[model samples]
Target: MRAIDITAPGGPEVLEWREVPDPRPEQGEVVIEVTAAGVNRADVHQRRGFYDPPPGAPPYPGLEVSGVVAEVGDGVEGFRPGDEVCALLAGGGYAERVAVPWQQLMPVPDGVSPVRAAALPEVACTVWSNVFMLARLRRGETLLVHGGASGIGTFAVQLAKALGSRVVTTVGSAEKARRLTELGADEVVNYREEDFADRLSADVILDIIGAKYLAQNIRALNTGGRMVTIGLQGGAKAELDLGALLTKRASIHGTTLRARPVDEKGAIVRSVVDNVWPLVSAGALRPVVYAEVPMAEAAEAHRMLDSGEHIGKILLVR
Candidate 1:
């Protein structure tokens, strides 16, 4: 087996593809022969010596993958060798083979190819958990997503619209705004030209900008709005206005999927399969893939993600 190893704390150049021992399934786990891995900002953080994998997880950087089951361990059921599946992982998807808890694996939705299935797990679970589940975004409500051109952002836009919410998103450019509109966003605000906060108020906000958008996000919330912060790409420190939040009766939540327990992840996976997968299968929601780089050239994939030029997910194919 071969995997992308981070040689040191640094840039994308630190990711190296090298031969590694094959992973074997443990109790309630399954070993997958890698097909493709989803590149994420967390992988970038991992390569730069931040966001270490949880205890007992693989040392690789990837957070999601699509692959074939090669083996299953004790206590695992309902899945077997040769099964085509995509999984949400804590780590190790950037390898030729990875062992994952069986609970996190999901069958590829109908009409989606195995290669593209690699794009679904991470973004689907993230949006479903944060926007729908945590924020309880209801039909007719407005949901605002930051970084609308990103994998999570793109998924969030489509899923919210498919579920009957009015979707508003923030992007870096006009081209991205156009793409988001095509993806079903009712409104797309170019952050470079306008302030999203001044333009609209939302019942729920799927924010990725963290500290930089914290104050503005509060101001953009409707009364009793819920704001969930999942990424800190814009820096991690900021002041919070308690007066504004109190006046609006708004709430803020901070969450990270990678550090969650397997059982918790499994619950989210189950929710996605039940609620989100049907939409994907029925063509109401779609995976947005911007590029597919070879597995060995994962650094190139990382560069693509960092460039902010892509409209959706970038995959590393085996």
Candidate 2:
């Protein structure tokens, strides 16, 4: 098998496709023959040596993949060779095959192509766990999502709307704002032109930009609001205003999907299968794919993600 190997801590050019040892399933794990892999900002971070894979995880950059089962380990039931599935991976999706815990696997939803299914797992698990489960976004509440045109952002916007929330999103361009509005966002703020904190208030905020938006995010939250920060695109360090949080009775949460215990990721995957899959099957939610680059050219895919111009996910197809 061959996988994308990071030659050094640097840019996308460092990602090299090279022959690697074939992975075999461990206890409760399954090996997948990859069809497609989702490209994420985290992959770029990993390539730059900013975020390393968790202990014992593969030293590859991908985090989600859609593939067919090739082998199952002992104790793995419900899946076998030839079964098509998508999985949330801790690492190693940028390969021809990857071994993953069976618990992290999900059957491709009806009507979705296996290639497109690759776009679902990471974004779905991230959004569902943070916005719905952790932040407790409720119907009729306003949910603000930063980086609205991103894979997670696009999914978050549609899912929140489907679940009956009013969606507000911040994007870098008017074109992105228009696209998100058509995707069901009730309000779209162009962050380049206006300040979102002064224009709107939200009961729940799904933020990707960390330090750059911290103070403003607090100010934008409605009383008793909950804000979940999942990415640090802006920076990691920021000064928090406890006084403002106390005055509004607001709460802030920071989370990451990778590096979590397998069982915890399994739980989130199950919840997504139960709560989010139906919406997808019914067409209320959809995977927004911006481009499909060849797996061997993962460096090109990484460049696409870095451009920040893509409206959704960029997939590396086998």
Candidate 3:
């Protein structure tokens, strides 16, 4: 099978396409003939050597994939050969084939394409785990998302809004702000022009940009508000003040979907399949594909994500 290997850590150029051994499913896992893979910011971080796949994963990048089942391992039931499934992978999604644990599998919602299904796992699981499960963002509460045009941001917009939260987003430009509004944000802040901390108040903040927005999150949050930081795209380090945080009873939660305990990830997957998949099938929630690149050109996909000019998700098609 052909898979992407990080030739070395540096830029998108580091992603190398090469022949690798085909995967064989382990117990409780299933082998998938991958049709598409989602490109994520974490893939970029891994490409640059800031992150590494856990043991037994493809040393290459890619965190989620949509594919057809080829084989099912012992103990796995209710799915078999030819099932169209998408999985939230811990790693190893950047290949023609991948082995997924039964626990991480979800059926491709009706009417959702394979490419869109590939885009679903990472951001959907992330948003579900953070905003819904952890933060418990309530309907009618004001929620602000930074980098609102991003994969996670776009999904955050739809899911948060669907659940009744008034969504606001901070984007880099007017064009992106406009795009975010289409994604369902009630308010859009062009971070290049307006200071989000001063202009918009939020009861809950979902932040993809880290350190740079840290202090502002404190200043912008309502009392007892919570901020979930899922990515540090802007920068990881920043100055923080304890006084304001204490005063507002604000809490900043830094989270990553990958590297979570398998059982826990499985639980989130189950809940989302039951709760969110219906919305996707019904057209209430959609996976936004900003660009699609062939698997061999995964680097180009990475470049688009890094450019920050795109809205929604990017996919590496098989």
* Top lDDT hit: 2
- Model 2: weakest 10-residue lDDT segment is 300-309
lDDT of 1 by residue, 1-318 (tens): 999999999998999999988999999999999899999999998998978999999999899999999999999978999999999999999999999999999999999999999999999999999998899999999999999999999999999999899999999898998999999999888989988889978999998889999999999999999999999988999999999999999999999999899999999999999999999999998999999999999989999988889999999998
Off by over 4 Å in 1: none
lDDT of 2: 0.96
What does candidate 2's lDDT look like per residue over 240-301, in tens digits? 99999999999999999999999999999999999999989999989999999999999999
- What clash pairs does model 2 have? none
Error of 3 at 14 (Å): 1.8
Deviation of model 2 at 45, angstroms: 0.2
Please report the TM-score between candidate 2 and the true structure: 0.99
**TM per prediction:** 0.99, 0.99, 0.97
Q: What ordering of candidates by lDDT runs from best to worst?
A: 2, 1, 3
CA lDDT, every model vs. true structure:
0.94, 0.96, 0.89
Q: Give the TM-score of candidate 1.
A: 0.99
Model 3, 230: alpha-carbon shift in Å? 1.2
lDDT score for residue 53 of model 3: 86
